[model samples]
Target: MDRRTACLHQANAFREKALADPEHHDQWIDEAIKWLERAMEASCRAVITMEGDDGSDAPAPAFETMAPHRRVIVRQ
Candidate 1:
């Protein structure tokens, strides 16, 4: 699975645990948020790279394609 999908799976797992254990919800939420933030950062980097703004010495991709839920980066 892609980064976004993996992050979402992690978030859902945390959510399920949070619902069952209110005392540990804080930790679960923190973990979930971190996964989400990482996913968004990954997506942003992907977008910039796809757009040929990666600032790398290597050549740009001849064609670019984004994964699903790439909009999360913009929404963030």
Candidate 2:
């Protein structure tokens, strides 16, 4: 998976964890926030890398063809 997608996956995992238990919601949220920040950073990097200076012609990155994400069903 791409870095952004990986980060989002981590965030979702933590969110699922938080939903399953109420004892450490703050911790889970914090982790998710960190992952989200990383995801943003990764996205910025990808944009910069893909669209360098905008003067030269470049093909779209494979990241654009995003596939559907598999939903994780938590047995709550």
Candidate 3:
């Protein structure tokens, strides 16, 4: 599994444990939140590293160089 999926699985496990164990609720909840944040970061990284239609794994353009209306466009 990818980093994002792994992190999400970890988060879910933590959440389930938190719900089931009242004694360590705080610790499990905190861990779950941390894993969720990691998953989100991994997802963002995946999007940034996505290959172009030309099959080239080029880096995405800098946000500063893009116009407001074109910032979301991914050029090949």
Candidate 4:
């Protein structure tokens, strides 16, 4: 599986565990959020890398508009 997928799987696992165990709910939820964020960042980076800067394929506005060191904003 891809890194993104793996990360998402881990997040899901944590989420499930959190639902089952109330004692560690906050900790598991926090871990799940971290994994989900990692997955999202990796997915965004992959998409940016796939789109060449030479404009060979369609223009990637999201990737092109991003500045170095700027975090990508993802809306749920």
Please give, for residues 1-76, the per-residue lDDT of candidate 1 as tens digits.
8886788788888888888899999998888888887777666544433444778887865544455554534332
Give all candidates' CA lDDT scores: 0.71, 0.71, 0.76, 0.78
Better of 1 and 3 by lDDT: 3
Q: For residue 71, what is the lDDT in candidate 1?
A: 52
Per the 3 Å backbone cut-off, how many clashing residue pairs does candidate 3 have? 0
lDDT of 1: 0.71
Backbone collisions counted per model: 0, 0, 0, 0
lDDT of 2 by residue, 1-76 (tens): 8998999999999998888878998899899899998887766552212435677677744343222343323241
lDDT of each residue in 1-76, candidate 3, tens digit only = 9998999999999999999999999999999999998887766552333435676677655432323223244555
TM-score for candidate 3: 0.62
Most TM-score-accurate candidate: 3
Reference-based TM-score of each model:
0.57, 0.59, 0.62, 0.60
Give the Å shift of residue 9 in candidate 2: 0.3
Candidate 1 lDDT score at position 42: 61
